[model samples]
Target: MPNSLNPLLQTHFDTALEHPNGIKKLRELILTLAMQGKLVSQDPNDQLASELLKEIQVEKARLLAEGKIKKSEALPAVKEEEKPFVIPKGWEWVRLGEVGEMQTGTTPETKDQSNYGKFIPFIGPGDIKNYKIEYNENGLSEKGLEKARLIKANSIMIVCIGGSIGKVALNDRDVSCNQQINTVTPYNSIFYHYIFYSVDSPYFQKTILQNAGGSATPIINKLKLSKIPIPLPPPAEQKRIVEKIDELMALCDELERLKKSKETKRKDLHQSIITQMLEADSQESFQKYFQFLTTHFHELYSVKENVKELRKAILQLAVMGKLVEQDPSDQPASELLKEIQAEKARLVEEGKVKKSEALQPIKEEEKPFVIPKGWEWVRLGEVLQKFGAGSTPLGGKSVYTTDGIMFLRSQNVWNDGLYLDDVARISKSIHEKMKGTKVIGNDILLNITGASIGRSTIFPLNFEEANVSQHVAILRTFTPSIVTYLHKLIISDFFQNLVFKEQVGVSREGLSMTKLSKFPLPLPPLAEQKRIVEKVDEFLALCDELEERIGKAEEKRGEILKGMVNDTYSRNCI
Candidate 1:
């Protein structure tokens, strides 16, 4: 290898080894080189591929004379315009059918019990994975084999139908395949591996897709498959290329193993750091590990999963009252709870809200975590003036209109805020009937059903009024001053974790109104709540910056890998 080429290959491999997609691209590059005759140097002493072509022709003629294989129609001669590239001096470009017998198989009648008793392996496209077929899951009887195309072991099979079209694999043993597979038996067995690598090349796959066109079910017929051009190298050069490919592919496997091992260690260390901060015995110990994280923010946040963990940790700390210090100067959370209770009692007496039955006292064992001083544990229903999910309008989706009152579904709610892109709507009369489910500005919406049960969002003041469906619930705080803090609490991991644990039902699990009403909420002093929200917003802004930086860094790395491949291939092809 040239000294200049070594660095390009190394840089490409080093940059992408950490990601699965990157390793895939690296494999594509390997196959690209092998197909282009760039993986191994050509030797002048080796016989020319044109001479090998004559020998392949002789073998084909002998097979035809012996009546072992059916004679295929002579394909059109290769035109100069059809050649994709200029090959080395000892190489030749020939139509694939010129050197191989390509045939499609069939399935026998399934109703005949006698056709199912034999032990002949029956292969399909799904049976082939990676580069070789290890075993066939189905079998055929002697009667079935009479109607099936029997391909010899080591022949190449390419899927010719549906989504698996162009998927090629080497048959390790003799088998009968379905109509979706096209088997290619080369005239010379020495060229089997060479042709297998060629058919698996990126160029061949692209050509196959181009021929498949835009049909509902893409397929490749025998004629189209045979017309695919092959760049044949001298017999000796093909052997050298295969050997080099095997050695380098083995190296790639080792590199992939090492990358995954290193990633596992990094994840373990990252989790340990988070655990240490969350389980700290004192504030001093917590800050020590947190400082280490801030100093190495770029290194730790490069992985998206790590950033998600950071986000979760921030939310957990906020709900635990550890995000901000307790203020002895401010009134305690017990006083706030008492004031909310008095307000709720007044509303029930005035007929403004419904009177509800008393809630069960929280047991000590049910408390998930300890709260800081000046904090109190209360059921979520205590602070809310109203709490209930909505109901779907009569006729459900049939009542929806293109332009009318907005209809909010579970999909409309996200962690940060409401998403209106896929929202539905109803007329003014329908909105009137849904008065109980109507939402207003500052109202928090929670998805209480199905896959997105824990998602919560606050409706913005500037948006038009809307009514939610059965999947969403509206939570109206008795005191409007703490709405933002309440919204944050709903989004916090502490609340979400509890919601998941208390969900009910079997077929389609849901968070029932009773369960949600009894959810334990950690109440901090009003003044401290404000401080905690501000601190969380500031830290979240920093996390957003880290995410943007990581995205750009990955984009730049991808561009470098792409440029290296394009530049190296362009220069080498000349």
Candidate 2:
């Protein structure tokens, strides 16, 4: 391949390799090039499009004189300024109405049931798919056909109203459509395929769609649509162009099938590897799987969905004590639990936090997964200094202010962190009134109810203060250092499964404080907890970086495909 054309072809192929929609864009490029008279070389010996137009005009005049069609006012000539780009020699600029019989369709009155029956397919915007009319069972009776506009076979139908505007279809069988469609029956049968392809081009789509910007429901009348210009090629060239379009589209279909097949295998391989890592019971087996995964990280993490699955496995492994090794020198978690209890007692005595009901000791079978030698499992209630959800302020959202104290809701919390883009706010007085819900630095906020249930985040330490809504529970550890580790634990699949089961009520949607407190959580050594947090954060940060690269690749893929199409269209046209 020549140097200039080689890169375009490689980008085009790479686009299909990387993303599924790239093929769809490629199809658009094909249609655009076809319509621009650049898809096939011109044959000087072939009859010119201007001569074809003359024959089409003569056919239209004969049909009018034969009383087969009504004679309407003459269509205006195509102006030089109205033409979008220069056409090649032997091609001609022509108005859509100059060579076709245009008709707008209408629906019959719905109250008359007799007007509707299975007689002929009633084409609508929804019936148009990939440039062909899909024959839905919305047929009309003979009585309805009398009231409806008759559309001949091989007519190009286009939607002219609402969100489905600019949808076009070509029908081979006789059909009638609803009021939203306009059909053009070519005066000469030879022009049907080429005319359909022209109307289906991205250029035509843009021409009609540009008028739609400001309307609530976009619309273009039959007259305006008929006045649009078309670049007509000689009949032989038109045939060759259509043939090339079909061949290229078939290749696109093959590319899409192969891409999807390869993608499915990658996903299955990626997920199976992740599942094995999660299921491996022994340290040796887990290490084997982890090493294989790490060695092939680039291959496994190529797709965003694959990276997401890997993140889940990493989180589960972190909580299960499989991510890092245990050090014999670190303090055992049982010792730390005693200290947390002593701190909790001090808070209770200070009257700073309410003394909660005692939780049942975890039975041996209740443990979700085995922990390292230095770790112990404890009820979530045992380690917390405070636990409660807040109430919605009086008057609800009407009382919300532009800015004051940050009011955190379930929407603001995510597994990764707090997203305050749309966080609600309240006056300082309201924050003061809602003392039970006040949040501090390093506090773990958990969404306890509704669709956002189970999401948790650690409040930023640098921020002064914030408050929570009824759906979000404030989880303050007896020791502030445990906050980050606990937040990661709460978001892991191991803990989320507990949050979703056996709720306070039959709904199983709202997680009560009782259920949350009784939940079993693995407690690692203080130093080990820090290590686990660091390792987990590092893994998650890597996942984010991989996703960022994928996102940038996707953005570049789109820009390259679009630039290729636009550049090809511009260069081919002028």
Candidate 3:
């Protein structure tokens, strides 16, 4: 290894591994640099690669004379454009065929009983993992070996076909393998690791991809594999490069192990802290836990998963009436319910809306949790003027238009807010046809079906008019202020758990409007509802900021790793 390059390689290897994928990319960078001859310095005293090439040719000629291996057709000379990079002084470029003998394997007939049981190791792509040849789960008999190619130990094995393409491994034992693999036996012993590293390099893999041809499945045949060019260092330098790669790779493995260990520790600490907070018995203990959380928030919520947990906890606290203090001066929720009942009755009496069917009373056992003094439980149907699912347009996607009334699908509804970018639109005539499902402002939209069940948002005032599909329900309340509170309830884990229970045994069928109407809601006083919404909004906004920061930090790490790899490649190889 070059003395000047030593510190550079160490610096890259020692860089903090904030992301697992980043460390993987760094490993590739190390292999790439090694293959390009930029990983180690050249020594004038070492034998030139031109001399090494001559030795390889002599070995191949001698092997051919001995009739040990079949002579293949001469490969075309390497074109200038085919060379991915220039080598250091004394290094040379050579086709892989000149320094290796290629052999492809085949699978024995499985139906033949005589070939079933054997002691011979029969390797396949699946048996090769982490660049090591593990013991084959299936072995071939002597008769099976006759039907397959037997590759000797120390040979380089590469997957030439199928989804496992470009995976290379070095065998520690003589093995017979199936036809998907191509073994490259180096002409000289010195070229084994060098060839292995070359085939594993990103440059060589790109070449394989460019040459792979087939309509159904891309593949590289032995002939095409033989012609792939490789940058050759002197035999001594090859040894040095392989040794350096081994050292750096070992370092990378250690780094990855350490990262996983650290993450496990952080996750344990994070879970313990959250458990203490959620399981706190009284207001005093809860406040103490909250104080600890605020002081050590960054340590606990540095990861996206931890931040997501924080969001869920906030919502849980909000719905349980534990988020804000209840004021004695505020009106109780039972009184608020009476007023809503009166308004509902007045509308029914005036013939403005039909009287809703009486729902079964909430059983004491059905109540999921206890509520504060000012809160009361009520059915979802009791407080609404409008409640039901929408209808899909007659033509589905065919009837969608670029401009018209907004058509809200389940995808458009999110926990945070409605996403209108991918929301469809229908012609004005179609919107008129679907007048019953038309949504005006201040309406709460809930996804009542499929994967997004329970996700909801309040239809914005900016959206003058819109329609919903059958999967979403348009909910209008007696008061606009309560819609925000209801939206929060629908998104909270408390409601989601109950919603999931309602959907059980009804797989393709969605949540029934009847069942949704019967959903018991823990209603807080009108004044406290506003406070809960405000506090939830405040904490959720913080979670949003934390999530965004985590995302940016991860992205920044990726960019820095990419820049380091690209900058190194350009400075040394370009």
Candidate 4:
């Protein structure tokens, strides 16, 4: 066996606390050690599994005579080549069928859902969770029970078919399962929990799955299952291994809880720091908090989630007019709004765009943040020439072609920009008929439905002519300077939260065109808007750098842990 202070194992144990893939890596190491016969030492005094097999054979004959179970054909002895690993002196590798009988439960052909009673809880694959059998109110009728096989308490159930193939559970209470499950009734007095843990091992799962049939839902027939090889340890050793595993697993659980607590504390601390910065009474207070954050940047901004939170905080600060000092010389947003109105009126008179309905004035309750001097809160509809969703071509396949007109879907619009690679193409004839829905360069695209409700992207100059899907809404800004600022506002956490709150639906919440037009926007002065966009972009780039570094560090840590586990197993086996 490996030494207690083996550097490799020590490294695995030490670093596993922080590695993201540590649990999976630890499980793999345990299986590797088990397969190498290094998990528990062999006891020479214990009876050999070969001798136990003889006793089982005699017991099987007795059961056959009593008509307790059906007799089956004798299985061939395990060949030397069939042995995958070396076993301890007293332990042996034997067919699973030698120690237990494997049988499948029945699925009723006809059953009324209304007839299901409370007492007889009918179990299905869904009833099994985390290696324990749970019962539901559904029950098998008398006729159904006749077809179904009754499984005794303590019997192990294995999901032999469907999506959950290889999942094993133990029935603490007598239960009946559907056709998809196989039940194993152990003849020996070995703890059923030990057997359950053994078969649930990743090694056993992989081996059993290899022989499973079917193209879609793989299944293990009774014949194939009975022939599966199982490693038998001394009954005392089985108990000891289970106890050791329990102790180690408790340690892992504690580590996980500690990690979660640490993350929660970090998130709380980040929010606290941001709150102090945002709520600073004066420039002096802001500088103090900012300096503290910058000094302990590595400690405060280690997690990717924290970096994303930081980006959102930056946007909140920018729109609230806290990012940069407000200049008294700059033009006020009220004057800028008048210019946008004049521009829209000119477009309407020129027959370039249709006039939108008047929106309600921003209410006192609707103001999310205090605006700086020269800034004004206004509806998004007041600043845009047109805000509406696109329409789909009704001709279906006839109107769609491999290469014709580019159709922009909701997915094409990302937070950063538009993605054009997978954009669908529509026929030129169809594009001509839908001329009003055409998207131009610098036009902002926003998702108005589903999970990506508030995502916005600017149309690139390269794709000047593109038709958007119904899910995407086009916003033609009346002023060029405000487009980037508006995009950033929509992408901000405060506005996104508002979108989610106002969204209407049971299954899929969505923002309608009517809602989009009326959504409140914090309008900064035209020059200030430009400055805010520039500063947000610069900070976002830094967030990206931090995220990339954290990801690489996590990956390196995982690799080190995996290497340690492998080295530990190798030394232990040798």
Candidate 5:
């Protein structure tokens, strides 16, 4: 409704103002402005878009005569009622088929891996990512290429169907694409980039999705694409808009790169400060390091991820006996180890638990950090009464029931804790058959495989007799106090990084039971362990609160930025 901007500009900017999705939305706004003939002023002397369209039609007819492409049927003129908004004086509205040739790419029925010979870039929807074509270096064999349509460099490719529909890319070299993509080649050089930008605009993208009629895999056929209208700007102004857009987009890219670089530096700084505190030789040194971090807490803890790393550092420091002052009067870890060994022996002798295989001695080179006076390094297997994998439900889907005993999968075990709310249920009969795999209160569950490998959680008291899927392993402590310390230690950065590095497998990576049982842990004095757990929990809770506040602050900042951009456009339009 604002008259200051040409109606087309006002409408484009207004729609952008309503939903500033993110940085991506900002880029789309610039493109829409460029395509709608609002980004740059047109000179009265410059040739009109109608003249350019005539030249394009002549080229297309010549190409058709040469049999380069088939002659397309005459398209219906764009109706006056279908026009969305008024364009600038030198621009005209035209159907996309009037400016370029629309054609589908080829689809191979089958691929032979052995026949893949030379390196030629094969592009699919996945390859056309973020407006750029990423070519897989390996090329298909002559037989594979037999089924594909080859596209030349500079041709515009758009994914017409599937999950990546509406994505567009400018091919940098000759390439072959899958059936999901449609390729468009401009008839002339007058506004090739401008036309590319027009079709890739958010408006056209939405239109494509809406017009794509299929239920399963919605597709925009060549016929539908031929009817899509686009605003054609004069040649001179098109160049100017393209230049301006390139400059602004470069700035956005720089901002993203700088943000990521700064985040990486902040993480490194946080790690350095944590290392200084953990490696402090004496109480005074520890006090100095701690004070330094506390003084710059605001500077270091501004981001939620930094705060999370700090929380992990806090746990690591606690288990290493560096988080709190050690008491000389408390029983030594050496004595505690003896008690744990005796308990394990007793359990094995009473036939209450099975004895584990002999664990390898901790090598001197394997010790990552120096322990305090009363602390000792011990293998994790020595402290546990039982450590073994869970059982898989029999008959798969048939054994699963809606109202029955609970079954905890590896997915349910998060680093924070166990999530029992969405657990799968199995019949009581199945639960009874796998009684050894049944989880009890205070049982520690650890994910042994897949992407979320090494995540652990303590089972809550609510689930008394729930069994676990095979992917999860149970670790029951010999002493209740050791459970807390061990859980903290396993979740610490030191152990997690070690686990990630040592994980093995070609196809799927995970922690092996043999490797897990041999992991070295710092055992502090019994009383000191209790003190460390309490301090870690207190600090972790504080981190959680800080993270929530940071999330809310980021959301508010994004909204404010969107508001500022919107206000500027609104004022310009008025």
Candidate 6:
């Protein structure tokens, strides 16, 4: 390898350690440099590639006379414009067919039982992975070999059809493959792996794909494949290039393995601490675990999966009344429930909202977990003034307008907030027709059906007027302050698990509002609910910030790897 690249290769880990796909890209860079004759220095004493070409031609002529391969039409001479870059003094640019005997494979008929299994390896595009051939158990019988093209050992195989067009591998065993693959057995046996690495280089892979035709499925026929340009170096330099590629690739593999190991260790550490924090019986133990995480969080939460776990832990603690301390001066949740019920009754009596049917009492066994002293268990429906789902307008999608009242669907509702970028709209007249489902400010919109069943968001307190589809429910509370806490509860894992159990989707049915009305809720004191929401908002914001910073850090790391690639291209190759 070039002496100058040694230092750059040494720093590969430092540049790529933080990048998710850094090592994989580094492997590609190594091969690209090798293809451009920048990987290893040239030796004047070695035989010229011009001499090697003459020897290859003589071997092809002898093989043609032996009838081992069919004679193909002469490929056009390489144009000076075809070479991507200038090569070293001992190197030459040649068409790939000039280096060896090339042939496209064919598959035997599957309907013929006589062509069943035997010892001839039946290779296909699926058998090649990561530049190596992984042998399959299925083999073709001797009769099958007669009907298919036979490739000898030490051949370079490449997929020339479909999405796998550029995939290449080296096979060390005699094989018969399907029509999707093409094989090249080099004239000189020493160039077997050298040829394999050459086809895998970025230059050749790009050429293969660009030449592929067919609008429906990409395909490069044997004639097109044979005409692809490739650089040929002296035999001695070829050996050196192959060795350098192997060494660098092994280093990349080690870096990837180390990164995965570090991430796995970090995942286990963060998951273990989160488990402890959630299961802590007393506040003191919980604080101890939380404190450890607070101090060592940077180390444990570097991976995004750990950040996800932290978010979940925050929601669980908030609902269980352990996120913030309660105050003695505040009204307990049971009294709060009574006041909410009185307000609900007043609304029903005034004919503002339909009188809700009596909900079944919460069973002791139905309670998922225990709450703090000031908290009370009640049905989710008990505190709401409006507890009904919306309905679609007269004409479903045909009545949509470019500008009118916002028509919300389940897709518009998300845990973060409503998304109106592609929201459907209806005329003002149609809005009046669907006034029964009219949406107002301070109302919580819940997705009662479809894939986003458990997601919800509170409408802006003072925003544009809108209407909702049948999939969304209006969950307006007697008190505005409780809506935020209720949103947190709906998104939590505890509530999500129970919500999924109520799905009736095989019949195109939604989760029944009756079942939702009976769903139990863990209600904390009014004062504590506010504090929990604040704390959760604070922590979740930190998570969002951390996630953003991680994404930016990864982007910077990617740029570092990209810098290496651009540098090699500019400095090493013309």
Which candidate number maximizes lDDT? 6
CA displacement after TM-score superposition, residue 103 of candidate 3 (Å): 3.9
Q: Candidates' TM-scores?
A: 0.94, 0.91, 0.87, 0.89, 0.80, 0.91
Q: What lDDT tens digits, residue by residue, belong to model 2 across residues 1-574?
A: 1243223444577675576478878778777777766667789998999999989989988999999777866778888887877678999998888779999999998899888888988878888876777898768999999888789999999899987788888889889999889889999888688888888888888888875544577898888888889999988888888777777777778888888898899898878778887778888898888888889888878889888887888889888888888899999998998899898888889998788888888999998667879899899988887788877899999979998998888999997788989988999999999998899888888888887788898888889678889988888888987888888888888888888774556564678887778889988999998999899889889999999999898898888888877887766544
lDDT score of residue 257 within candidate 6: 82
Q: Which stretches in model 5 have alpha-carbon errors above 4 Å?
A: 1-23, 42-46, 54-69, 107-130, 133-154, 171-179, 278-292, 338-363, 393-397, 427-433, 497-518, 557-574
* Reference-based TM-score, model 3: 0.87
Alpha-carbon lDDT, every model:
0.83, 0.84, 0.84, 0.77, 0.78, 0.85
Measured by TM-score, the strongest candidate is: 1
**Per-residue accuracy of model 6 over 1-574 as CA lDDT, tens digit each:** 2345656655765666677877776876888788778788889999999999999889889989999767878988899777777788989888988888898899889999678587688988988898888887787888988898889999889899888888998787888888999989898898877888889887788889889999999999988998998889999999999998888887677877888899988888888888888888999998999999999989987767888888988998899877887788888998888888888888879998888678888899999778888789999888787778999876679999999999999999999999988999999998998877888888988888877888889899788989999999998898787888998988888788878888677643677887888889999988889899999999999999999988888888888888776677566444
Report the lDDT of model 2 for residue 256.
83
* Residue lDDT tens for model 5, 22-71: 45656765676666566667799988888888888899989999988888
On the 0 to 100 scale, the lDDT of residue 300 in model 5 is: 85
Q: Work out candidate 3's RMSD over C-alphas.
A: 3.6
Candidate 1 local lDDT, 173-288, one digit each (tens): 77888899998988899878888888887778878888885469998888898998888999999999888777777877877788788777767778888888877767788889
Which residue pairs collide, candidate 6?
none
Winner on lDDT (5 vs 6): 6
Best of the two (1, 6) by lDDT:
6
The TM-score measured for candidate 5 stands at: 0.80
Pairs with steric clashes in candidate 1:
none
Native RMSD of candidate 5 (Å): 5.6
List where candidate 3 sits over 4 angstroms from the true fold. Answer: 1-5, 13-16, 38-48, 76-83, 104-148, 160-165, 174-181, 189-191, 210-221, 395-403, 427-430, 505-509
Candidate 3: tens digits of C-alpha lDDT, residues 402-482? 898889899999977788789799999999999888998889998988888888888888766889999999899977868
